[model samples]
Target chain A: SQQGEEDPQALSIQEGENATMNCSYKTSINNLQWYRQNSGRGLVHLILIRSNEREKHSGRLRVTLDTSKKSSSLLITASRAADTASYFCAKAGAGSYQLTFGKGTKLSVIP
Target chain B: GAGVSQSPSNKVTEKGKDVELRCDPISGHTALYWYRQSLGQGLEFLIYFQGNSAPDKSGLPSDRFSAERTGGSVSTLTIQRTQQEDSAVYLCASSAWLPSTDTQYFGPGTRLTVL
Candidate 1:
């Protein structure tokens, strides 16, 4: 069963614009992570936000977590065509070693 | 300095045949995980191994699926009597530890196509 659910299954935006993707999970999590996957390739870790933290940033990526709301959001500033890939949100449940991933949001940054 | 790696980037097998996928995690990493992603679907957890502890096999879908991590470094996932529904991309990942805070490095998945 899936724990996280990302909103806006697919999104298209112009390069240099900001793109925001949202994710909501059903259970309490130890941390939330976002990853990007190029076509026919592996996923690359983008950022991680712990349950105790509300927000984090890495390069052009920003992640916000709301434990009470059981949701998280990922923002990519100044999007590029390289960012045209599927983005996934995964959560590590408390005390569990495995991560449950959500149906990813496919983002297309048109050049 | 190497990242995780998997062999046979693509595989085509008959519906009744078995298949084995290999994953070599980053050196010194103590945690390993396997997940399956069906076309247009989210990743489904398959198994996890942490150090010397027994692996977590709860997420495995059926008795036809089994996995093993030998010497705590390399892992293999075996599917017996594959079915068309078993076709998907099998992804492998590893981390320094089993904690939720640790970032996992993923390997290029093995695209298994059961005919």
Candidate 2:
């Protein structure tokens, strides 16, 4: 069963615009990680935010976690056409190695 | 270094037949996982293996779904008596099992179509 739920099933923005996506989960998590998938390929790890972390930035990507609200958000700055793909938020259970992933947010960057 | 790899990037089989999907994780990684993704859907966790310990099969959906990792390097997922609902992309991933959160490297995935 999936532990996370992403909002705004799809989002479209012009190049250079910033895009934000949100995810909410049901149970306590050891950590939350984001991944990107292009077309039909496998997913690539993007960023990870531990339960203790509130915010993290990696290059153009910024992520914020709110353990109190049981939610997280991913922000992409100066988005480009290359950023068009599906983004997923996965939750790692506090005491287990299993990762339950959300349905994902499909982001389309119009050139 | 080579990333994780899976065999038969695409597989088409008839219902009631059996299919085996393979995954070769990055060298020296101690953790591997299997997930199933239906069309335009989130991945469903199927199973997990960590080091030499017993695998965690709690996520498996049915008795027909089974997996095995040989020598802690290569793993295979087998679906017996395939059903049409079994059609989906089977993805494999591996992690280094670090002290904290570990990032998983994935394979291209095998697209299984049950006719």
Candidate 3:
């Protein structure tokens, strides 16, 4: 599928625990990006991994990409209560200008 | 500098009424996009505008949905003869270039409710 469908539609974890979310796409992508939405508002750009790159990190966020499998994962280390939000993976399809988004994974970090 | 901004944070309209949602992208951004999200769903691409190029309107759901970017800065999405099913949050975003190489900045979405 052009859209990157995320797995484990919902995730519940302790505040100090690490959270991992997975996304798989069928089409080849130029790049994949992870975004976080708080209170269902605007999405904040997290990390982007290009087709040529395997991994990227930003603060407590770690993202890994596997071009061969058309899958990507986002890992948030020591997630806090504030980190409770919906995470989405968007694919910038090859040669296309717009992004195709997936039904996101709702993450709830319990205090 | 300021981030992308949307107007009328919330809207409620009758079934036959039309509503227009506005978006002002960050200054100097050359590309803008419009998306819709129903309750608990992902963003749905609606339309895209690039500098001086024809807009991509393939994702629009019906003839009643239309959008236009004026002077390549502000955009307006109009929905006519609104149905209850049309209730959703409409989001706007902008980027310096294509998302393949740039990050898209999003605005606080406009939540529309049609009765």
Candidate 4:
């Protein structure tokens, strides 16, 4: 069973725009990680934020987690066509080693 | 320096035939995992392996599905009497540390099509 759910099944935007996707999980977690997948390819780890932390940034990507709400958001600043891909949020459950993933948000950045 | 790798990027087999998928984790990685992604769906965890400990097979769907890790590095997933519902992208990933802090590195998934 999926432990998390992402909003906006699909998003389309122009180049140089900003893209924001949100995810909400069902159970307590030790950390949350975001991943990107290109067509027919493996996933690429984007970033991870521990439960103790609220926000994290990696290059142009910004992620914010609200444990109180059991939700997280991924923000891509100044997006480009190359940034178009499926974004997924994976939650590592507390005291568990497995990561439960959410239905991803497909982002399409149009040139 | 090589990343996680899976063999036979694509596979097509008849229903009821068995198939074996292989994965080689990054050197020194201690944790390995298998997941399946169907069309337009989220990834479903199939199994997990950590070091020399007993594998966590709780996620496997049925008794026909089984996996084994040899030498604590390479792993194989075998499905006996594959069904059409088993056709999906089988992905392999490995992490150097525990899930609490480790990040999983994925390999190019194997797309299996059962006819």
Candidate 5:
């Protein structure tokens, strides 16, 4: 089971501040992805970093992977109220069909 | 041009009753997945259907849970003799083909409450 464990079950930050979340997995993985869930219903994919890749950036979101430590981090720079949501880290391993997810870090961006 | 769609956004059933949740994946998407998310918990993989291949049921919690994909498009997840523990938000996602590392478009999810 390559289920990732997200750090800091919950976080609250002021607008314009940066929010960072970390995830650690148990075993080797093929890919690590981040998703944001809003209103507890739909989940939107944020980024995907393969094992071969080290870092990726999309808009204000940045993700770093350290396979040697089996950990990954997601950084949301200059967060806004609209960014308040639950963020999840999921992993896909070689020969694995499903993406195992972590419990997620709940973010609250205050205005 | 639409994303994944799920029917009966909310379902309430008595214990021991049967309920079927429907998922309509995006047009032309060949991979469909079903997952259950309990309150404050992560998404629990339920089943996966890709093309005409056999579904991977390794994540199903029990024999009472089953799913089927028809014509390689729509999917239905059926829970028989449902229990209180079955209460959760059932999410449906679909990708172009496989569930590996590709982005999966998710539906709004069907919230089920087993009384």
Candidate 6:
């Protein structure tokens, strides 16, 4: 079974708008990572937020983790058409090296 | 450094035939993983290899699926008696360490279509 579930199965937005996706998990985790996948390709690692951290930033990507709530959110500011892709959240469970992934949210950024 | 790489970007095979998917992890990466992604679906964890330890095969869907990592670098996933339901993108990723404080780099993946 999957340990994480992402909300908003799909999102559509115009370029230059901000897009946010949320994910919730069922178990305690050491870290939560986000990835982006283009059509017919493998995933690319975007960012990772540790359980002790509340927020992190990398270029246009911002991620927040609320361990108390077992949830995390990814914010992509000033989206571009190139940003159109499926986003997934993977949680590294406590004491486990393997990551469990969520169903993912598909984001389409129209230019 | 070179990233993770998988062989045979696309494959089309008949049902009941066997197939072998290969993955070559980044040099010095100790953790390798296999995942399956169906159309319009998220990735499903298949197996994980950490260093020289036993692999975590808990996520394999059935007995037909099996994998082996040789020398802690290259891995292969073999499916016996392929089925149409098994058609999907098989992805491979590798991390430098366990617990993944470091990012896991992914390969282009192999698209398998079991006809």
Question: DockQ of every model listed?
Answer: 0.78, 0.61, 0.83, 0.78, 0.74, 0.71
Highest DockQ: which candidate? 3
Please identify which of the two predictions, 1 or 3, would achieve the higher lDDT against the true structure.
3
Q: Record all residue pairs in model 4 with backbone atoms less than 3 Å apart, i.e. clashing.
A: none
TM-scores, all models, native as reference: 0.97, 0.96, 0.98, 0.98, 0.97, 0.97
Any runs in candidate 3 off by more than 4 Å, and if so which? none
- Steric clash pairs (candidate 3): none
lDDT of 6 by residue, B49-91 (tens): 9998999999899999999998889999999999999999999
**CA displacement after TM-score superposition, residue B21 of candidate 2 (Å):** 0.4
- Residue-wise lDDT of candidate 5 within A8-110, one digit each (tens)? 9999999999999999999889889899998789789899899999999999999999999999999999999999999999998875668899999999999
**Which ten residues in a row are the worst by lDDT in model 3 chain B?**
B96-105
In Å, residue A93's CA in model 3 sits off its true spot by 1.3
Q: Give the number of the best model, judged by lDDT.
A: 3
Q: Give one digit per residue, the lDDT tens place, for model 1 in B14-100.
A: 999999999999999999999999998888989999999999899899999999999999999999999999999999999998658
DockQ computed for model 4 against the true two-chain complex using alpha carbons = 0.78
Model 5 residue B19 lDDT? 98
lDDT of 4 by residue, A1-111 (tens): 577788888999999999999999988999999999999569999999999999999999999999999999999999999999999999997667788898899999999
TM-score of chain B of 4: 0.98
* Docking quality category of candidate 6 according to DockQ thresholds: medium
What is model 3's DockQ versus the real complex?
0.83
C-alpha lDDT values of all predictions? 0.93, 0.92, 0.95, 0.93, 0.93, 0.92
* Per-residue lDDT value at A58 in model 4: 99
* True contacts recovered per prediction: 0.80, 0.58, 0.73, 0.75, 0.71, 0.71
- Output candidate 2 Cα RMSD: 1.3
Over A1-111, each residue of candidate 3 has an lDDT whose tens digit, in order, gives 448899889999999999999999988999999999998889999988899999999999999999999999999999999999999999997767889999999999999
* Residue A46, candidate 4: C-alpha displacement in angstroms: 0.1
Q: Which pairs clash inside model 6?
A: none
